[model samples]
Target: MQIKADSVEEYLAKVPEERKGAFARLRKTIIENLPSGFKECINYGMVGYVIPKSIYPDGYHCDPSLPLPFMSIANQKNFLALYHSGIYADEKLLKWFQQEYPKHVKTKLDMGKSCIRFKNVKNIPYELIAALCQKMSPEDFIAIYETNLQKK
Candidate 1:
């Protein structure tokens, strides 16, 4: 499932042909809808959206050498995955997404603390994903991340 590619374009090229279109569309949706200030790259082996070192020079607390990751999309073993840090950190945003998902897709939401799993590419609900991408700005995410770090 882990397509060991060095770049986003390379990663996409290695995805199974049956899934190439859906994954590409999902990636496009995130790139187009994400607020300004988030930069795209390959992070943790997935296509990542991050607050770059130029923006947050402190970098990720866990690894100061790396950018602060905001989101990522991966083609996993059984499904496509969207990893959004905002929904994991903010209760209100999580609740809103939980409430809205049923309205967008009939199937029950398959989610983890930060990962939303899409088992069916045909029902990826691109609009809902678009709205989710726009829900947090880099500043907003940085504030929340700092607050959580302080709590620990």
Candidate 2:
């Protein structure tokens, strides 16, 4: 679902009524456990956590005007989607998350390169997401981004 909102509150308001609670809790869990230096804002039409320009002035490599996006949560048409850049860029982190997912949710993991899809909102596994949020910091993300940048 494409939610055209300018703020996190606005985005939350647009979510389906059935998903409001789960989505809110998911957002809260991320915000609460998110490491220092990442800021929350509406990014790419979702609730995004990013390293602001003040911290990384170069901004996103794709779009210098926008902050470097670390993570984003979207209330998709069929499920809630979490896009974490760290997992997409860091192999160890990706493997760790993949291995840890089964312990948190009984259902088989449904994931993409960077997007983790939660088809059942009740089984969202907020705690695992919290742990994932705490796993990387802004500096760590930037270093990985730069390292990959060099490879490219």
TM-scores of the candidates are 0.98, 0.98
- Per-residue CA lDDT of model 1 for 1-152, tens digit only, reads 78798998899898888889999999999999999999989999999999999999999999999999999999999899999999999999999999999999999999999999999998899999999998999999999999999999
> For residues 1-152, what per-residue lDDT tens digits would candidate 2 score against the true structure?
78999988899899999999999999999999999999999999999999999999999999999999999999888999999999999999999999999999999999999999999998898999999999999999999999999999
lDDT of each: 0.95, 0.95
User: Candidate 1: where are CA atoms >4 Å away?
Assistant: none
Which residue pairs collide, candidate 1? none
Model 1's alpha-carbon lDDT is 0.95
